[model samples]
Target: MTVRAVRRTSLVEQAVTELRRLVEGGEWPVGSRLPGEVELSRLLGVGRSTSREAVRALIAAGQLHSRQGLGTFVASIAPVTDFDRQLRRAELAHIYEVRVALEVEAGRLAALRRTRADISALRDALAAREQARGAAELVDVDLEFHRAVVTAAHNPVLTDLFATFLDAVRDASTEMVADQGPSPEDHKHDAHAALVQAIEDSDPQAAMAATRHNVEHTLAQLRPERP
Candidate 1:
């Protein structure tokens, strides 16, 4: 095999590439703090300015987030493309429209495909939601229930796309929960129970109906008539 020389690139670009590799390769996981600029510069054999520029680039690209008084941390391994940032910034109604479309299909598919393990996971999430004591805890558990349903659909691409909307979903849920007075039951407990039953019974049509009911109920709560 003939050896090929590596093409040269700017130090900042090289640092950015290596930093991405470290993050994507799981050497640095999401939410894990990254090395300081001085340490990263020494580690990557680049100047501190180059390392700082690389970090700034990653921050702008949404792969890293820096907290005041805290070091930089990996925000996500999945690069937030322009489209994804738009999705993240989308209005609740727009995001819910897409969420309803995706989840209705996911509910049907999950009913047909969910395994025993999936059912168990869904039950656990539901139980957690029931036991949740505060608005924040309920929001987290509520999202977990939706995530379990999507996972049960057994579609990796759907799962990834849904994952990107989670922060927006969480924000919406927080607002809705706060507006509705922090009662977890105010957020579709019966509809979710029906959904779980439909999925457990492997009834696709029932699952779809249950999913639609839940989405519509949420929309009504968030956008009450002004009459």
Candidate 2:
């Protein structure tokens, strides 16, 4: 079989990917100066423009920074890979446990900090979730509603943290939703609705309960034989 030809984008993407791997793997630790563009092009075996673009992408990702007189330098070490890899490998139960701990607090904070705009976004996300007719659509909308709740907390770190592993959450949700098979097109979810209501009412404990209630229902279905 013949291998597909690589495009210019694939070239730059791999270059950036390799750069991130080097940085995250500690080969190129934080504050260390990166090799010059000429050297980087040589190392990555690509054109100078390709390496330049790769560096620009990493700079945008907050992994690297450039100085006027000096070359590029590692800005910060994103410890995203190792932990995220483990998280991806984790079982559904373990992932759900993490989700509950994280989201319960998010819901509590959201209840306290939600603005009117936040509420509108939550309603829209929940509505989309309710209206989802396909499993893929449901998986996306489910996470979208949860993301709206996390956003309502008004915590940048919380929102960034959730966004970091959102794909993992989506993968788990896809499997779980697909496992349960098809849901009725007209059926609506009450647990998430309860969550939205609790947040709307500014009731922190109720929000936490609603968040836990929603997760527990899914976890319960997964462990059907539990007493």
lDDT of 2 by residue, 151-193 (tens): 9999999998888767556555654553454444214578888
Error of 1 at 161 (Å): 0.6
Go through the candidates in order and give the clash count of each: 0, 0
- Which window of 10 residues has the lowest lDDT sum in candidate 1? 177-186
**How does each model score on TM-score?**
0.58, 0.57
Model 1, residue 47: what's the lDDT?
83
Candidate 2 ranges beyond 4 A from true positions? 1-90, 182-187, 223-227
Show pairs that collide, candidate 2.
none
Candidate 1 deviant stretches above 4 angstroms: 1-90, 183-188, 224-227
| Candidate 1 lDDT over residue span 1-227, tens digit each | 99999988977788889999999899999999998878888999988766866776676567887675578899999787757654543455676777799999999999999999999999999888878764556677888998999999999999998887776676566545533456434455788999999999999999999999877666655442577
Top candidate (TM-score): 1
